[model samples]
Target: MKILLTAINSKYIHSNLAVRYLKAFTKDLDCECTIKEFSINDRIEKIFEKIIEEKPNVVAFSCYIWNIEYVVKLSNLIKILDEKIEILYGGPEVSYDGEKFLSQNPGEYLIVEEGEETFRDFIEWKLGIGNLKINNIKGLYYKNEKEISFDGERKPMDLNKTVFPYEKDDELHNKIVYYESSRGCPFKCKYCLSSTTHGVRFMDVSRVKKELQFFIDKGVKLIKFVDRTFNCNHRFSMDIWKFLIDAKTDATFHFEISADILTDEEINLLNTAPKGRIQLEVGVQTTNNEILKNIDRNIKFEDIKEKVLRLEKNRNIKQHLDLIGGLPGETFDMFKKSFNDVYSIAPEEVQLGFLKLLKGSSMRFETEKWGMVYSPYAPYEILSTDSISYDEILKLKRTEEVVDKYYNSQKFGNILKYFMPKFESPFDFFFKLGTYFKNKGYLDRNISSADYYRIFMDFTEEILNENTEILSEIIKYDYLKFNKKKWLPTFLNRVVEKDIHKKIRTELKKENIEDVHVERFDIDILKYEICGEIVKDTKYVIFDENNEDNIKYFE
Candidate 1:
């Protein structure tokens, strides 16, 4: 028997780890298992053709909001090509709205939460076992033309019981990295997908170490941890982290963590981790207390702030902070403050996202009351309503584009923070830039930092002209042209400049500066000294140059 697992990822970098987990579960089943991947950028019909070409007996599709539409379309094409090939779908996107979804989308079975064991049993039953029954399975919503049935909830596997005994398949390693530390989440964030998979469970520490060893032995460079809150269980999180720290493993592990829950001990352990060895993604959805309360996310803003700041000081862990724009009671101004506040923490990456009113989430139930009108399609992204205008939400989406380009992917933390406060709200600031690109026919759907910065600076100059303070603080921008004299005078006037300069000098000291050179620029009686290299004849003279007499000091 042959089984094929696949998904349509947003990018090769964004492939789903679910495929990996499924492969691990079915390795011992003795069925020939094959995995394939499709991306949104690929032509859908071609993907269908490829799947048909492989012609596996069973095709299991890993579904998500980003790729469900493509999956459904592909599934329909599969039915057209050959109805005999069994089709199955699973993942968070289809976990809810199962009955309706099953009715509309025929010829597919749904695997509910924690699919490893249940999917295996179902495959076995189909292989030739008579009197097959799905009701015994804990986590499945199976359907036939005559009836739709809900299987009893499947309990999560003992993490120790899960293993990837199959030979390492490096063929898919570059496209995706499979992962899972535990099942379910401990927090009840109203907007989250994992809330439905609550009650955090952990893998036996020894088994986790073994898995890490396997990936290392295979020379896999990237292993993404699918744990919703990696550090939620404290001791388990600590043990795995410490093991990785001690092993000094070459493979990189990416985790999504709730920063507020990080204890001092964990922070200390993380500090010892080698740079680029670990990447943490923290969700700082909003700073507004009222909004947080309304959404039932019980995290304290102050605690989150403190933990993030401490973690950042380590200089080892690469941090990514996340914020959602359309939440209950969060206006454009409130979101702006959230952006500026989170940006100030100086995470290596900051993601600006629009809210998705996922089916079965608490937000879905509250949307009508909260005045949310989301897209009626697969992902169901929130549009806007009385609480927030559609126009405003559109602006936030544009802002998200700019943020992804400049802040998140580009790694421009310093420059972005320096210019953050100029516009009343981050949405306004970035959306205006987003609009300029769209208007000029210059917007690259997949824009790069080089593409974005060029347009951003064009608009930024006008905004900076009105607020010189914003420009003055941007010490890194070359085009701003703040010579030492221009910058020093402004720096001296500020009350905090001394402390700021001290920090700069302290950091520079770590680099062990070999020398310092000062150059004086004098042209037609205008004379100035700038603290940097002097290579051109700009009526300038190096302080130690024999021609220093030619340049007079500026009065």
Candidate 2:
């Protein structure tokens, strides 16, 4: 029998492990299985065309918020094309609503929990044996006309029974590396799906070492751990960390961790981790005690600070901190405090995210109590309600972009740090910039980075020109460009000669008369957004006679 299993990922870097598990189980079981992968932006009809072309005997889909709608629509179309093909659905999305979903749709099967052994049995029964009974398969939710039935529960599979991420396929070896050191999460955060995965289960240390050796031998460049809280079990986490350190693998491993649970021993172990080998992403959600309590996130503010400082002080690890905007009782001012506290640590990246209320999470069950209003769509991303207005959420969304470009991208933090003391805090400064960007109609606008940089510089000029004292704090610079050299920040301090012609001549080592050229500006063409008028001295595109295409324009 031929089986096709796939997951629609939000991005190619986030491919699913479900397909890998299925491939491992079916390899030696005398079954032919293939996987078709696509990103979220890929068209559904195109995938259906491919499926029709393949004409597989059985089609199984891995469902999640990012790809459920597309999968469901395609599955229905496949049924219409050929009613005989067996359809199966599994993943976190269908794990909760499998019964309802299967009952509503006539000819679909739902596999709950881990699907390796059960799916293997299903394939063997269908392909080899005739008229075989299948009611005994564990963790399967089968639906009749009006009722849904479930088989006996299945125990979690031992990680030792599985293959490493890159062991199954050659394409997956060097192109991508995604593995999990542990399963389940200890904390019961309301908005997360990890809580539903139950208690933590760590893969054997020796097995993980073997996998790391394979990855190193293959020269994989990137490895991402899907573990919910990598630092939860101190011994398990530390043992892996020490092994990776001793192994001295060349690949970079990224781990999501709880900052407050970090121990002194773990800190020492992390210190031994080679520079650029590990990157840590700490989810700090919110600093407000009331909001944290409402969401059942057990973290103390002081401990968060202390732990973050310890991690940040180590130059070996790159730190990424995150904050969610639309949580219960988290006011704008309260969020500002959260931002300020996190900004004080100065992480390499600071991500401002909006809350997502997944279907199976505790937050979805208590949305009414929290006054949460979310989009009635497959993803169900939260929009603001009574506690947080839609307008405030919109502002937060823009704030997230500015944070991405300026803070997270590490482009403007050096300059923005100077304004931290002048404004109330870093959050206040970025919030005001977000409002400015929105007011200028650039929030959702599709503008190039070069154009946006010019526009931002124009705004900064106006703000600084209003108060020259700000100049004492922040550096004023312009990008220098040429055929041999590209645009690079040239500090104002570098140009002691005030005259433009003299400065150009001195910098380029050319005569003033030869370096200078007379240029004309169509006075009516310089559109300035802040002043709402045209400037007679300059035009939209300033070009040099030597290089006609070399020009920059701003709002």
Candidate 3:
């Protein structure tokens, strides 16, 4: 019988590690199992039609919060088309609500938590290759004549026994390949699903190194560690990181780490990594200790700040920091302070995510105590809490949008630096900017990056009443430095010395002025950008993003 293992990812770039692991773990069963991957952004009907075309005898879905709804809809459609085709549900989403999920959905079996061995055994039994029937297998919940029957929880697999998920890199090209050298999380952060599973298990360090080497040898573009807290075990983590650093692999390895717990040795080792070889994602959800305490996150803001700033000083690694909006003890004002607190570090990306009361997470059970109202859907995003209103949450959502467009884009870096000082706080600036965009209907639809620049100009000059002349020149400098086109924005003062452009082009042995980009700005934008020093005088600047020595300033 043909078995199809499927995954519906939240995005095109994300490959589901669970499905890969399950397939690899059970590969010895010798079933004709195939894997299908699609994005949640894909239409459900289209996905349904594609699955029907596969014409498999068994269909198994790897489910998660982001794609559960789509899986449910697709599974229903598949059942309608062919009831003879057996269905199976696995992954964290269905694992937590196994009985409930099986009762409501078109699935005969729910492979509960830690699915490797469970799935292996089930496939063997279903194919009559193994005598151990479905009921006796731990971690298997099956339909007993319209009633869901469950066996006890299965032991977490010896991670070493877990086979390397990929034999070849053909399908994973350009996708973010996920690797799990370890499973489970040590900390009990109430809002997170990891808190549901206790303790951490790791594969053999040598084995992990060998697997990672496989990715490096295959020239994987990016590998993200699915380890909840990558550095929970010092020696194990250090060994792997050292291997990655010394191997000098071109792949970029991303990790979510607890910055507060980092030691000097760890910091120093991380500092030595080749630039772009390592990237960190730190979860500083809030600076409010009460909120952190409520979530059982034992971290001091000061400690995290000190540790993160030390990493920042290195300037070798790209850091992405996180901030959550709605929490039990954090009010709107508290979140404002939290936003500003995280903003002070100015990491490469600031993810302002709202609280999601995931099904199995502890915080989901205590929503009433916190007066938290959330969506009753798959994602279950917090609508509001006693501390924050829905309207305020909506505003923060808009603010998040503007932050992604401007702050995260890194294109408006120079312009933001110039304008931020006039504002009260970074939070104040972004919130107002978000509101402004909302008021102008800019956030409602797609707008080009050039349009964003023009809108920013309007906000700076018209609303802030700042000197348009200085702002325009700064924007022009930024635009030229970041953009390729020789043309300047129409709103900006494009008046340049024709003689200087021609002289510079000739000096570079170019036949036309457009062949080489050299602009004379009214102010030394680069000097001002590098430091607070305002030259307030004309200077010529070259623009080429690809060149190592692109932004050369000439007097």
158-228: candidate 3 lDDT, tens digit per residue: 88888888987457678999988889999999999999887899999998888888888888889999899
Rank by lDDT, descending? 3, 2, 1
lDDT of each: 0.71, 0.73, 0.86
TM-score of 1: 0.80
lDDT of 3 at 99: 89
Q: Could you give the C-alpha RMSD of every candidate to the true structure, in order shown?
A: 9.0, 8.3, 2.0
TM-score of candidate 2 to 2 decimals: 0.82
Question: Per the 3 Å backbone cut-off, how many clashing residue pairs does candidate 1 have?
Answer: 4
The residue ranges of model 2 lying beyond 4 angstroms of the native Cα positions read 128-132, 145-147, 173-176, 462-555
lDDT of 2: 0.73
Give the worst 10-residue stretch by lDDT in candidate 3.
508-517
The TM-score values for the models, in the order shown, are 0.80, 0.82, 0.96
Better of 2 and 3 by TM-score: 3
Order the candidate numbers by TM-score, best to worst: 3, 2, 1
Over the stretch 336-412, how does candidate 2's per-residue lDDT look in tens digits?
88988988988888888888888788888888787889997877888875578888888788778888887776554
